[model samples]
Target: MRRYGIQPVASITDDLDIAPLLITSVGRLLWRYRSELAPVTMLALLIGTGTILHSSYRLWWPTVAGITALVAGVLLYAGRWVNLTRPIERAYAATATAFAGGWLTTSTAHGPFTKPLPLVLAIGCVVLAAPWWAHRRRRARVRVERTLAAWPDIAQAAGLAGSRVQSAIVDLWGYRFRLGLGLGQTVEDAVAAVPRLESALGSTRGGVRVQPVASKKANRADVRVIETDPHANAITWPGPSITFITQPAKLGLFEDGAPVRVPLLRRHGLFGGVSGAGKSGGVNVLLGELTACPDVILWGIDLKRGMELQPWASCIDRLATTPQEAEALLRDAVIVLDGRADDLAQRGKRVWDPSPARPALVIIIDEYAELASEAPQAIDHADSIARRGRAVAVQLVAATQRPSKDAMGKSAVRSQMDIRVCFRVREARDADLILGQGMVKTGWHAHKLDAPGKFLISSPDHDIPRRARTYLLDDHGVHTTTERHSTHRPSLDAVSVQALERAAEMPITEDAPPPSREAEKVLMAALRQAPAEGVRINDLMRATRMRRTWVYQRLQDLARTQQAEQVSRGFWRATPEKHAQ
Candidate 1:
């Protein structure tokens, strides 16, 4: 083999010691050719020397031939033979042959073959090394593959065990995991599987927890297995395909195989779930179904910049984005509720018993927590509404990410809310709080929810819990439904408005006023002297000149400001704050 120009071979053998020698030899050859360029420059020097010598000696042919060969070789190297390839090599060879032929055809004293020979050979050396470089790259890849293939079977066997345990591989954005049961599992056995897998796979420090899925069906005997990893973040459903059952009095969907249905306008309803647990989508499904009924007026509150409830704004009678707006809305709602209550009371009815003529008002809140946080006034107003709003054909559907006592409040508002919708939470305590204490024993842990939008709905009527499928509400569905219902706007009954206004104005202080100023001064002096425990609306009317309506309105304003608390329907309490003020 011509060591300076021949290609090197890549070895397939494990102990290919000759491969390095071949590479070294090839590198030396390439270096030798690179040095040959200097010889070409030396030849050019000789050509110049010869040309000068010929010029001085009057050797015209010799000088012309040397200059011509130098020019040709420079042009060939610069323009055609820069990169060594077959075409460049052929061209270089042809050019060298032409230079040699020209030198041969010329006089003996003028031949310039020596000048171009080194340049052509140098190009040839580089062209020969191309194949050796390619061969080395191929051999390296093959070695890697072979090394990987030669690994012990134990490495592959570890993954194989997990494959049998995987029930399903759920791909939630930002996370993915194999969800199923591990072998040798119990109710507690499934719980044990996670720690082992976490240890095997090296636990991530992202507060990720492994939880067991509870079986709901008692009668059916099937091998129940629930496997979840923190990596299995959100369970995404295919589309807005919710499985729900509708009845004359109630309509509901199943959450985690638990049935949650509410009676139509039966004390209204409340929903609380953490963000990304499909709270918005769940509400969308509820509203979508409710809007289909012609008798319901949809009112909504979205304190999260209005994006959540804006879609349904056109279909709804009123929508509020700020606490101030919500205050006005609740104020208006109270008015409406009072009017309806009075109308029902006049008809000897306690509640708005559903009839074909009497349509119900459904108020939906997307983020009740935000509303409560921003407007504490609205919270009390909401409490009052929830307490009395249902009797006048008004209902509420509120959803929140945090359903803690502070967010929804435990005392007044939460007690009035009858229905609960629990989604995936970070704690079992949350599931207990939302779904009731029985949920934890049933393994209805919200923290273990594998799917993003999945939830567990619990209501007073549900005998056995049923899993409810959440429906995805796209823009088109929202827009079309809103447009279709644009013509039908729910009008607040005039009677309800008047009764609410009347209720709001109920007398707060017996000494505050009567029908006129003269009688008011008499009651005021009496109150100033005695400072009775609280004021009665009836007593204020009897003692003061102010009319019943005027005295009532002033009392309501006082009660609203907490100057006095409404003790009973027509009675008021003078708080210490009121006395101090």
Candidate 2:
């Protein structure tokens, strides 16, 4: 029985030995064909070496130390490549060279116990490929720079100055300098090279007049050129151009630099122009510039189905599209103004006191005619906001295709909107309505603006009207600006919509019949039991828990219904018809 047990034990030991040998053979075969198997085989070899050293020496310190160093070194080298550091690649190459040399020396010294040479070869191969990868990246960068350098000149020749230009390559950063004529050019050359010089001049109804500022003494080249209010400051080009200024030069400022820094919101401008005269586009430019100011809170109203102003919905705090919405917005603004005025009166503070904390509110309206036509009540509210809103730092900028006195009634609203912009009106009378009387004499005729987005700006303080360029907002600019300031959008939810619907559907309580009609039948029965007069308005209100106005109106309505009569201002008595059968 002992001999039988020993035989079985020996057989198990042989099977265990043969199993490892089979595993090693299969692992070596896999490592020969698959590159991924190199790391796996190295790990297995590390484990086998550790086991052998632990059992033979009864100590695993050397094996553990060697394995740890190998692991840490491999990870460090791999991390360098992952980080894309060129210097680290050089370090890896150096380490690989030293390792190959050390391995060759060790293998020659200890022949049969030599480690795997294939893994060393793989590391060396990866290190050798790094220079080619770095060279390809450098070439790609140079090609992008060359392509971007050519676009600005092409855009200028195409008459696209002062516009944002997009390039196919995103990494190109130095495209701004190549937009216009290069250095050492004369004034004539610069003007001639500028795209659409004639069109730009003719669109403004002004002749191009360039003057040389100074010339370089040694090179005899014109160093500077100035165009006299030639209407190129805010002109829209076919493509994009980088902007250096936040606000475009006002007509007065461009003419003689009078009112050097006019407060845009304080001016309380009104925009009036004919349809397709770029009135909405002008508002877009104004709002675009204003949004960059962190202090300003923009509000917008568009009664033309909201298409013109929806692009800027993200930047504006309030956006109202329908007449009811406009009325609500105006009423809310009026309430805010009144509240602010009351607070200021209490605090002994005045508006326009140059306080950053009390920033102005700018309400911009698009298609004012439609708003007036839909909600006639909004006219008085808007007028009130215009008249008294300025005291509380509330301002209005209303735009309309028709500037007739009938459209925007000739009242305090029109007179109070001091700053006005007129673009391509159908008649000289329309321009007169927008730019005061006889503005056509001062070159403020809308017939002159044949261009789509051109307009003439006129103010009470300016001596003469000047044509100001308008920018056409493309999709990309709108998307980018809106995305950047998306937090300003009004917070609307399903609950708010449902609440609005409920309010709209709710019956007017003043128009509703009194519950006393039903109560009167009971009261009449009680009266039949014991005759008495009708109930007081106060008692009715207290009994029904209705508002005082509602109860009073209901009592007046009851008098009309022949159910009650008011004997005095505060007294009521049941009528004979009401008491009779």
lDDT of 2 by residue, 1-581 (tens): 66667543444554466878899999866744343343345445544543455455534454444654565466456645544345654465455444443443333333314456446545654554455345544444454445444545543653544332232221111111212233454334533433353343222223422222233222121211122443434444232221211233332223222321234645577787777777877777666666655545667888876798878866776677778668867766675566667667878887643232445567898877777778889888888888898766678888987756677754677778777877787777878788778666534556566555666665544434444556666667777777765543222222222333333334645744444466545433432333244444445544555433344445545666887775432346667666674
User: TM-scores, in order shown?
Assistant: 0.46, 0.44
The regions of model 2 sitting more than 4 angstroms off are 1-262, 352-358, 488-581
lDDT of 2 at 461: 44
True lDDT of residue 140, candidate 1: 43
- State model 2's lDDT: 0.55
Q: Candidate 1: which stretches are off by over 4 Å?
A: 1-262, 355-357, 500-581
Across 1-581, the per-residue lDDT of candidate 1 in tens digits comes to 56788887866787667878999999876654543343355445545544554445535665556666676666556544433334555455446545443443342344434566445544534553344344432344343333333323312332323223222221211121223433433333333334343334333422223333334322211112122232233333223222121233223334223233455555556666667777776777677666666566677788876798877765675667777668756766776776777677678988675432456777888778788888878887788888887667677778877667788854567667777777677888877767766566554556766665666666665533344446556678777766665555444444653565565356545744424557646544433333444555546655665544455455555556765554433345555564666
lDDT of model 1 at position 18: 81
